[model samples]
Target: MTTVNRSARGRKSLAALVCGALAAGGLAAAGVTTSLAPGAANASSHREAPLISGQPQYDNTDVYAFVSPDKPDTTTIVANWLPFEEPAGGPNFYRFAKDARYDIHIDSDGDAQGDLLYRWTFKDHVRNGDTFLHNTGPVTSLDDPDLNITQTYDIELLRLRNQHVISTTKIADDVPVAPSNVGKASMPDYAKLREQAIRQLPDGSTAFAGQADDPFFLDLRVFDLLYGGDLSEVGRDTLKGYNVNTIALQVPSDHIRQSVGQPVIGIWSTTHRRNASGHWTQVSRLGMPLVNEVVVPLNAKDRFNASSPWNDADFLPFVTKPELPKLIEAIYKIDAPQEPRNDLVSVFLTGVKDLNQPPNVRPAEALRLNTAIPPASEPKRLGVLDGDNAGFPNGRRLTDDVIDISLQVVEGELLGQKNDLGDAVNANDQPFGDAFPYVALPASGSNGPLAQGQGGGNRSQLEGGSAELTASAGDNGTLVTTSLVAAGAGIVLVGLGLAWWRMRRRDGAVL
Candidate 1:
């Protein structure tokens, strides 16, 4: 390992130590775990990396996959933009990248190479002038509602098989843009406004561009402290009152699928921007294997993002390199009880079951969904743990409780039909709309407390306006202690061994 790599690993070790201590101290007792595990090195989604926390604009907030609830033969792919945007910050609102190239790549052949790509770009209308505030100011009425600050964008459907580009018709002139939610009258009915954004494609596919609810929900304060050293708890609470900006795309499954026989597909998103030197640069990439790059290790994160499924062969060595649990083991100073657990290599890098798969195509980290298997209309939030494979790793849905799913799987739920975790995997409220713009919650008010209403059970509401970002005492602060310290210690020792092996390799010493 390079000196920089070593240093990064060392820092990760120290972080793990602090986090372990905190977890043991019960600091995360009040925290809520959403779809993603907050503190563990085994995070399953993007933006979990320490570096990207400062860059929310490029954060891969959340990934959703489900057969279109309205159209059974089509799939709705919705990728959220801008994590945790405060609804009150207005005047200058958030918008999707205008110059940046946004793409949703799909791989249906099972090889991981994208067989089809949907590309998008936008054009802003900041120059247009219509200076009359409706329901206020001098005049009571304006001649046109369309002459406001609007934007126009185009979509391109690329067929990778033939390298063909199909462009859609331009959205002509100007259209009324949605305003920030300041009051009932100021904000248009969000549902109606979103419907207006949908543009019909020549091929029968439909696309909509506008701000929607953020599907991801986590008690960030709890998780951050957990990683810093608090494990008094082992589960998560649902986020019932938050929202995010989203770009939704729906298309006929056959339009993007490479083969009718296999319905499985790989999906990913990328954001790019032109630098001062006039060169386009990648801001971030979020795909099938979600945060594989972010949580892998600092030294390996960038390399993971720069490579793709097609070129994975050239990057397999780096992809299979392990550093997480090893670093944890080193920091905790404990010897692993098992052989493969000694290093993160065997579990995180090499597949425990299907070992012959391609490098980037490793099932160890990617969200693997067999599309041929029809989705369960009313999927159990616990997913495979509940004998339902329709959620997560199988392709995540908005309501799937991924945090619990990941925790259960890591505890050996995949080993057989029997799950020992029991209620640990069964305790969560999963509710989402069954149509386009699937995330149905409204944008939370800035000063309102985090509300905890059950989708079908015990309901709690935090009313009035209070600028607190935590759940009520009744729902929060529930802690459960476990033998995580011993487990953490075991993983750290494995890291030390791996480090020693690398040192020997550099010194030309025989094992």
Candidate 2:
């Protein structure tokens, strides 16, 4: 805000630019952690708006659409909900919104409107209500006898023409959804349990719905310091140890596309919950991460999420005159680009030209994926900026470091401002699978590293518990499961008290 502050920001802006240019070019495999890595708040759409934040299950967390590596002929679309989930969540765990309709939209014609809509509606089922335990026995399978509380869902694929549903087909009905990774006792061999939930659809497609580690990672504390921390010394990735309910679909390229249509498709995820009038009301929408989290002002965030992309023109001023750069300059002394920021508009609204853009596509918010591009053998998490067209803004891959890419974008990466700007957390807590439904198994409840209280041993139980939830991804430590055992013991104690009271009442009556 002051001249002195602006002077410092100017220096930072130039320094970050130099660092970005070098990183953009060929750099060492163990390259220096770019100085700008911790320069901005790299965030996702989890609880980004006021209204949607209240509806965690209906709130869209992250949307990813990438070419399937195992089956190149197919495309994978994944949408996650119930963000920032604690693996140790108790008696009442997370589930899908039965009252809402979740959808993944594809615009093969590049009109920024869905040409084909894949919708999901869920049903909650309690196998038995007499017991407090979620699982009466070990969950050996998707339909395992031990699983007490469960849920089922049906998927519908609808083709839209002229904004009216032309045809609707039930893709899968009464499909099983895998239970949360409650703990070893409840869900032993989560990997095998996950397989049973991966059902093949009648339309030559596949579906998976259940819990998975929260894929979006970023530094939450950096926002406090105006994002000026060193790459190696910034905020910790708070997203670790969290879980989310996910709905993933793998379909042939032609399923959502006409054989003669465009290869590039615009993808986005949205959720609608029924109002008191019994009419569905759009509550949340997400494509690119942090669009509403940081870009939209507080008052307009809910409206932005509820409105359609066709009305995006109303919010263009925020993208063009972003407040992030001004905040950086005011707090940390860096000058943002002058107004008329075509870069922000293009990146958030329209796809980047010649790289990920659809031909003659109208500017709108959606993750654009070019189906013709083959998946990278060893993908670059940094995305197209790193010469890997198979990742992020080009359709998000599970391995992509969206936080880093987003931080770079925050500092005007598209406007030629390049820095290693990021939260320093480069990968997800879990490793992705090689097959369709590629998400890694969810973090277990009672055991594994992320469970509460017990410095639980290695995340070796699942794939992602690599280190302290707040520590670096490469840092390894043992996770203790003391809390789970304690929790089990506490349940037993409560049950014993009830039984003793019942006996006491009976004896008193006899006397």
Candidate 3:
């Protein structure tokens, strides 16, 4: 069937699962579960590593982990930054944080301790010019051109082997840079410009720093409304018409891991800055767990973002905790006729392991992969859920259908049992490159509203109609039109009552 239909089918199956679960318990007679997850009740509505939530511009949105298809023993790590950078935001242009320190940590042993670290930092150069054209403008002679706002960054590689400090390199204009999204003729071979930014390390490892298309696709509006809002339609409504800033690094397997037998590694990224107090503050942190805090629970989300592999002991209990099933039970207001059945804890949680066999670590939130598992040259988008063990939770790639996979696993699809929910997942286009500097989405004109290109065209034809939702801006800047607050005074009253109730509870009164 078509990709759009497939995705729709997946959503219907998930909704069915919720309905079936509620029906079985007679909970459908009460109410639907629509309350927002406590963790999503923060200012920076998007997920970012804990410390970096304060800095929305540079908050690391997602970290991707995958084994390089071309090379064995090599891992590809991608960290995305500056969510929703409008192409029209001109003049100063987007740049990596200068004072911010970025890093990736690796752990060879399953205990989750870093055995190697890769770090990067940036320096800014502000030169004066006649007209400060941020992204696009007319080109002219540079005999005495102003050089205001030029920047360079440096990278460092540290090996825990013998506690040794290994390689260092500086990246500047000498390195190839991706051209801004002007016209193809004006920015002819922009991809080629991006290629220049890839540098070879002293250890022969490859690293790239530049902009690329955002790989994340989700119907975020549906999710926002799904959690305690008036709007109630659900189908995939992801950002099909936008892009994001990206910094990606690829390293040789041996360079990152010792000859030691274990193939597992602990990974995390950080952005740092010196506050007015002069102490360096870590703005963000992310590793193999992959948006665990954001998807898991609120009380644990911040701690998940702030802690490291070495200090995971402080947060492991929260990471491994099975709260969803309990939350589901509570929200559905179902009391067990006999004893409670926390199905989530029994099956999914207990099944996750660090290694393939004996002495396996209990299931946890981190994405665990066995390097010994050869990479699949031709990856199927269905991923591990399709019984193809090489995809997601094994180290996610952009093409993996995580939503469906998560749904299936949560609905007992992995236990060789048929879920009344049917197939709970689907994927969109399964196209991606197979080499270093993977292909990115093509640029579009920012002079008007962003368009979805061919993807939208195909979707429109398949739906046999056109989508009415469009983009709009509120006091908080650009937001989707569907995100506009619902009209009516009833919602206002409920909101005020909630506020007072919260205040009363904070004052230690029983509600």
Candidate 4:
């Protein structure tokens, strides 16, 4: 049966730090655990937003941008959705919404707003419905007839200025999402099918969508650590057996870069759903994993998701006097940075000064990357903090240990305070695959390594297929549909987009 670790140190200045109950102030002082977030192990943004918590498939989980290790001339930007997936998710498997719009925004010139938008829309197909199983027989390939649940998506890459679409082009179309890894017996050659899912776009870009091993690793026992627990107990990776839906893109380095002289670019992902007006509206978004989960107060989490980087300055109070640091000080007794943490503001809000920062840009939040910085030869997990400028906060690499790095920063290491902080679980359960879509293959639902004493059949693998996430979004049970899309995601966006394309073609306009 398929399943997954269920399982750090320090002391510091509480006197100078704000230690009282800080709910009114939106501060998550550690001792105040009532509404404080315990944080996921990977520093992931799973179900972090309030309204977004109500929508998982569209809930942006994590965003990673890096210079592709093998292809240094291209950059890989991966956006994940749906989380905590069990391998044995049968009956109805997890997937992207065929009608809803998913996006990856890049601020190339930086004023804290989008200069480029990569819009994704999916269309699914169901081959058979007589049986309760997703596959009638062993799945041999991505387009196999035995594969009942299949999906294809279109990527509309647009160049934007001042919040209006200036140029739009569908770079990729009909790209298939990889099939679920059911079991070895059912899918003997899973690697080949994964290869099939990785396709080349007309514009010399590469696209991949489907399940992959959850790349972020963290020792989640930090919940216990808040109460003074020993760091030794923090070695287990709680997210070990889970899988998530991923949309990975590899674009030529020059094409992805925005400004002329500046090599740095800011990136983030957002998901939009069709509302009553039949127009897609932003529902969820994420950049820094632990930001909304830790920094944004519980009340404003959803609003934060809906807002843009331009208006991020409105949330400055939360950043400068962050609640997460207060909690670390109150509970863990660690000395957090003093008010006005320019370091954090630089790292999270704006791009790091002179490194990834774009001049004249607003103080907006995004994961910035300096494309000129090549991938490190022997990468360091601690990233820039460890003298490896090629890793996270520069542009996240799969191997970067963001948890430990963030832990060190919040613990006042940036201020010259010393601490031997580490979660102990230094690596992913399975090392990353050395390929275009670097994420590991999706875990099989059947034949999980069922270690002793771990059994519970009630768990559903289609985790976000619930009223909160997909209530109006439409639900497709075991039944199959002839329509390219199944549920509440209206095709109005597709209709308008296609209409625009046809108009362009008819007018003989230069694309």
Per-candidate Cα lDDT values, in order, are: 0.48, 0.72, 0.48, 0.72
**Candidate 3 residues 1-511, lDDT tens each?**
0000001123333343234334533542353322111223221123433323334444665566678888867878877666554443344545776657777666565444555667766665545455565433332211113223444556766666433555544432233334344433234455555656667766667777655655655435423523334324334424333345566777776666544475655455655555444455544555442235323455555444544444444444433444433443454342212223233322222223543211333332334455566678777766665666567656667777555455444434545544332122244322456677563643433321233322221111112234444433444445443442343356887999999999999999986
| Whole-structure CA lDDT of model 1 | 0.48
Separately for all candidates shown, the number of backbone clashes (residues 3 or more apart, or on different chains) is 22, 15, 19, 7
| TM-scores for all predictions | 0.64, 0.80, 0.66, 0.79
> Ranking by TM-score, best first?
2, 4, 3, 1
Candidate 2, residues 375-479: lDDT per residue as tens digits?
A: 899899899879898887688898888767766776777778777766677777678888868877787776433443323333323326443233222345434
lDDT of 4 by residue, 1-511 (tens): 0000000001111111111112313433443222211222323676664444434466677889999989999999998887766666555668887758989988887787788899989998888767777887888888789888788989998988789999999888788889778877678888999999999988899999888887878766665644235455677776777778999999998997764488899888887766544555666677765677667777676567777778787788887888777777776677777778877888787777777887886787788899988899899999998889999789788888887887777666777886768777788888797888999887776534221112332122222333332111125343223232443245777788899999999999998
Model 4 poorest 10 in a row by lDDT: 1-10
TM-score of 3: 0.66
Candidate number achieving the greatest TM-score relative to the actual structure: 2
Cα deviation at 64, candidate 3, in Å, is 1.8
Task: Report the candidate with higher TM-score, 2 versus 3.
Answer: 2
- Distance from true location, Cα of 164 in model 1, Å: 9.6
Kindly report which residue stretches of model 2 are placed more than 4 angstroms away from their true locations once superposed. 1-43, 225-235, 258-261, 448-511
Question: After superposition, which runs of candidate 4 have C-alpha atoms over 4 Å from their true positions?
Answer: 1-43, 224-233, 447-511
Off by over 4 Å in 3: 1-51, 126-130, 135-150, 161-186, 225-237, 288-296, 316-321, 326-366, 414-430, 442-511
Indicate the TM-score of model 2.
0.80
